[model samples]
Target: MEVISGGFHAVFPMEDGSRVGEARRHAAQLALDCGLDETEAGRLALVVTELGNNLARHAVRGRLLLSPRPALGEVDVIALDEGPGIANLERSLVDGFSTAGTPGTGLGAVRRLARQFDIHSSVPGGTVVLARVGAGPGPQEGHAICVGAVAIAAPGERVCGDGWAFALQGDVAALLVADGLGHGPDAAEAAAAAIEAFMEDPLASPRVLLAHIHQRLRSTRGAAVMLLQADVASGTVRSAGAGNVMARLVSGTSDRALLSQHGTAGIAVRTPEEQCIAWPEHALLVVSTDGIETRWPPTVLAPLLGRDPTLAAAVLVRDHCRGRDDATVAVLRRKD
Candidate 1:
């Protein structure tokens, strides 16, 4: 089976009131582009508008990220902010409780509109909210796999250096995570090149795919790249990497790190070696860039591994991110 993964879409800034409308328009268009009906698109637009308004009204700096899951006919909306976190999340989600003196229904409405919704916030830690809307009722029970991700630029930069993408063909799913050598436009260019290369032939082995990305990115700034392929029917995962991108497979109470060799992809890389690991039923595969703190104690990892992949990615980025750089996390779980 061949799977065509959705491309990495644009990221919208919600810094001021002016950007809120832009966020709404961008999300609505993305929903339509992903094959959502008009009704679904409208609901998504409204959710975006509400989240944007909340950011503008309360936070110092914020962004709305739009990622499409074409395989499921779904669009993911993630709203992240820097400061002035909610004081009372429960009250904020109440139907009529407003801190800005408006209708106070933004968060409530978003929950109602989304197929899946989650929010994490703290007074000093800022906020990250996730909402996923599907074109239809969603996938049937016992789907082979479910994948979700989040990528954000450095606090002061407009483009993120980290990027990720996935594709499924039959029982196999291939995932790519790339981090450009540094932050900003040149870095984003390198990451984008890797993504383009992966999409060109997503079903290739991880080593071959990374080799192709290395060739395509030689002219630009180099990046750290990792490719992971899961064979659901065989209950196994194969991985290859060049540089600092990290991959891990997590079961109910155990975590296994999938190591990557040292050296940049487009710069200096040795022959890539693919590593394979057993993936138990209901286990999760997580791939992330150096921007995230890799050494999490079991205490920190336990709660996160149980949530939806989107929310798990969001929480990990929210709690473990190294604020000085661009951060990204992608989570994949085989459905039961």
Candidate 2:
């Protein structure tokens, strides 16, 4: 079975009811792009519409993230909001439970239509709902770990300069997050080049893979890159990086910040070093570009570490992103 990879590719701001139809149309188009039949596409549209309406009507500041998982032949819809979280999440999922008056079947219908559904909400903090809709066979066997990410270009940019990729071999899984020097076509070229080289031989140690990516990125502009290789059988993670890429490992009540050398790939790579860290049974690993603020504390993610990897990544981006450069966050966790 193919391992799942990639991030939320499109974002639609759901500030009001006016954008619901537009988001629904975009979701339908993405469903068709994933090769779903008209029935499946319609299902996806309804999910988007319902989620969008919730964001517009009740939530404070909200948006919808759409991830086209072509490998799974599905699309992931993530609804994110700033405040006014559900007072009673359990009751809200019922067919007739609504804080704002309308025959409240939105959340219940979304759960019924989606192939998979998960949600996390905080009273004053916010809420995140993940729903996947598709027509293809769902997640298959041999998925030892879960990986999800969110990479988006800076405002006004046509394409994102940050990129992420992952590879699985036996009990080991390798993940990469790269941010080109600047935000534009050239930066995107450099970031893409790094990913291409990393996948060429992902089984290599993180240090070795960084060297290879450094060489492959010589022609294009350089980038900040971080790689993590986790061995579930051994319960260890080896990480290597350069430039401003950031990584953190969250386990139990605490989280540890992973280190990276002070040099950029391709342009000025110094002697790379591999750092091996113990991987807790339920540990969660998050890697991101400088586009995300690095000063955030662990408590920000403490309540969300156990949620869907993609949803966690999206929350990080929504709250901590710097908004000045391309941002990307890749999440990894051992499957329960």
Identify the candidate with maximal TM-score.
Answer: 2
Task: Identify the runs in model 2 with alpha carbons over 4 angstroms from their true place.
Answer: 1-3
Give the poorly placed runs of model 1, Cα more than 4 Å off: 1-41, 52-75, 80-108, 115-128, 134-142
* lDDT, candidates in the order shown: 0.81, 0.85
What C-alpha lDDT, on a 0 to 100 scale, does residue 281 get in candidate 1? Answer: 75
TM-score of 1: 0.78
* Candidate 2 lDDT tens digits, 189-239: 998898889877877899999999989999988999999998899999999
Per-prediction TM-score: 0.78, 0.94
* TM-score of decoy 2: 0.94
lDDT of 1 by residue, 1-336 (tens): 434344443567777889888878777777777899888898888888999888888876687878777667889898888778888988888899987789989999999999888887778658878888886666433346777787777878877888888785557788999999999999989998998899888878998987888889999899999999999889899899999898888766677899899989889888888888898776779888999999854344454455667767876776688988888888887754
The candidate that achieves the highest lDDT relative to the unseen native structure: 2
lDDT of 1 at 245: 90
